[model samples]
Target: MNNQDFPERTCLICKDKKDKKDLFRLVKTGEDKYAFDEKQKEQSRGYYICKSHECLKRLSKHKKIKVDTDDLIKMLNLLKKGEKDYLNILRAMKNSQTLSFGMNMVLEEIEHTHFLVLAEDISEKNERKLLLRAKELNITYVYCGNKQQLGEIFGKDEVSVIGVKNKQIARGLIN
Candidate 1:
């Protein structure tokens, strides 16, 4: 899809127009009450905010939102927790045997790989090789966590890379 195909919304704090999916939607559940709509499916009055720390912090000062500082902190924490939920997704992929971890295994099944998740601290040599392969295959890739954190998901001592074969899961992870 082209850029025009995506709907846009203005951030209440920054007043910057951004793709709808790129902003966080806060729904007004009741009088002076708001809730984070993670799926953006809430049926009610909604406000959009940029998914950035600066914009989020400035949101508390918006007179229309009527959110307290403490509430803003809670919302920030909720957003963070949502990001960390990717670990659970990874675990599900592992259980379903749709994930390949470690350098050798992933390279062996590179043709079947839909997405690549590399450790933040991956060795420059392996990182460069994996990125080069991913570029050649046109596969989406991201740097997440350290080797130890990623390894814990697969019950390993350490893992520098992971390849996901499920197309749907890969798209979700990259998005």
Candidate 2:
């Protein structure tokens, strides 16, 4: 049998088809609707967490994301395979003055950029507005999957609130 003959699995994040590897598959029953199917819980509109902060960072920096087929393949190698700790991130949220993931990605070592990247789903207008403002203020900022990653860096989860190095909310989301 050829690769085409084999049952194909689609990723919800990038919306591409590939035989299951280490991808976190999801099933989307309807438009903008999806479910995490760890057990292959019936292909509906499965999404995979293959798009990690790295890829998100690149797109954010470029200020655009093209809906391309290969882009989907690129996403597959970027994200993590499972849910991260929201709580530990929460704790870090409280302790650390701030956290940012993309554009100014949090590498093992960070040199500068006194800004915070709020990772969450927002409109293009919002993204542009925030980017402009961050530039105006000379502050670092980026958006990601959710604000939770900010919390994770802070050692907790479900963080509705995120702070920057100066102990204040980032202008992007706060505004």
**Which candidate number has the best TM-score?**
1
Sum up the clashes in candidate 2.
31
| Over 4 Å off, model 2 | 1-78, 81-91, 95-113, 147-163, 166-175
TM-score on alpha carbons, each prediction: 0.57, 0.32
lDDT agreement with native, every candidate: 0.81, 0.46
Q: Which candidate tops lDDT?
A: 1
**151, model 2: CA deviation in Å?**
7.6
Instruction: Report the CA-based lDDT of candidate 1 relative to the real structure.
Output: 0.81
lDDT per residue as tens, model 2, 15-93: 5665565355555545444444546667464455443554334433432223334444444333432224322333445
State each model's C-alpha RMSD to the native: 6.8, 13.3
Instruction: Candidate 1: count the clashes.
Output: 0
| Cand. 1 TM to true fold | 0.57
